[model samples]
Target: MEESTNIDQCTMEQKEPRKVTKRKFRYIGDFQVSDLECPKKRRLYWNPTQKFMSSSRRKYVTLKTKIHRLKNRINYLSTLLTELTECDRKFPVPRSIDFNKQFVTVELIQGQFVPDLMNLIIRFADSSK
Candidate 1:
C-alpha cells in the first residue's frame, strides 16, 4: 500500500551518518583576487591571476542566495579562491600555475558554495589533502 511505502521511505531517511567532522577554510597562500565583476544577474567574474581571469575553465561553480546586504559578496568568493590556490613561499611567485595540482582544484566539484565561499574550499581540501 502507498501508506506502507511512505512509512518505509521515512524510516530510511531517518538513518544517520556514524560520524561528522568540522571543516575549516584554507586560505590561498599568496594568491590574490585582482578583480571581481558581476556585470549581470547570475553571472560572476573572478580573477586570481595577474593577467586577468578569463572564462577558460570547462566547468564553473555557480551559487545563488538571498542578498540581505548591499555588500559585494563575490569579493569574498574571489578571496577564498585565491587563498585556496596560492603558494606560501615569500620570495618570488611561480610564473605558471598547474590547475590540476593536488590541493589546487582537487575536489572542487564535491564542495558546496552556500551562504559563503568557505565551504567550497573546505571540501576541496578535505578530499584532496
Candidate 2:
C-alpha cells in the first residue's frame, strides 16, 4: 500500500505543470543615433531617455536650426547684392551693358575676386533663367 501511494504521488507531480520564472531585460549605456533605423518605430518607444530623445522634439529643433541658417543666408545675400550694385555703379562697362541689357549687370569692378564671383553669379543666373 505504501509503494502504491508513492507511485501515485509521483504521477500527480508529473501531471502538474512547472512554474516558469519570468525575466525582464533592460539595456544599459547610451543610445546611438545610428540605432534608429525606422521613423515609425521611433514614435513608439516612450522611454524618457536623455540619449534617445523624442523624434518630434528633435525634428522641431532641426527645423528651427534650418530656418535660422536660411535667415542668415538671406541677410548675407542681400548685403552682397547691395555691395555688388555699388561696385557696378562706381565702375561702368557701357559696351556690356548695351549687349546684355535684359540681364542683371554683374561686372568686373575690382580685382580678380570680383570677376570670378561675377562669372559664377552670371552662370548661375543664366542656368536658373
Best model number under TM-score: 2
Clashing pairs in 2: none
Q: Model 2: per-residue lDDT, tens digit, 9-123?
A: 9999899887897432123243345546766434333353533556668988999999999999999988876676689466443333465533334343334456677889999
Q: Give the TM-score of candidate 1.
A: 0.16
Against the true structure, candidate 2 has what lDDT?
0.63
**Which digits, one per residue and each the tens of the lDDT, describe model 1 over residues 1-129?**
999999999999999776877433232333324422334311222223312323323123222223423246677866766776675753453456676563444454555323246866888899997
Clashes of each: 3, 0
What's every prediction's RMSD, in angstroms? 31.9, 17.2
The all-Cα superposition gives candidate 1 an RMSD in Å to the true structure of: 31.9
lDDT of 1 at 110: 52
- Choose the strongest candidate by lDDT: 2
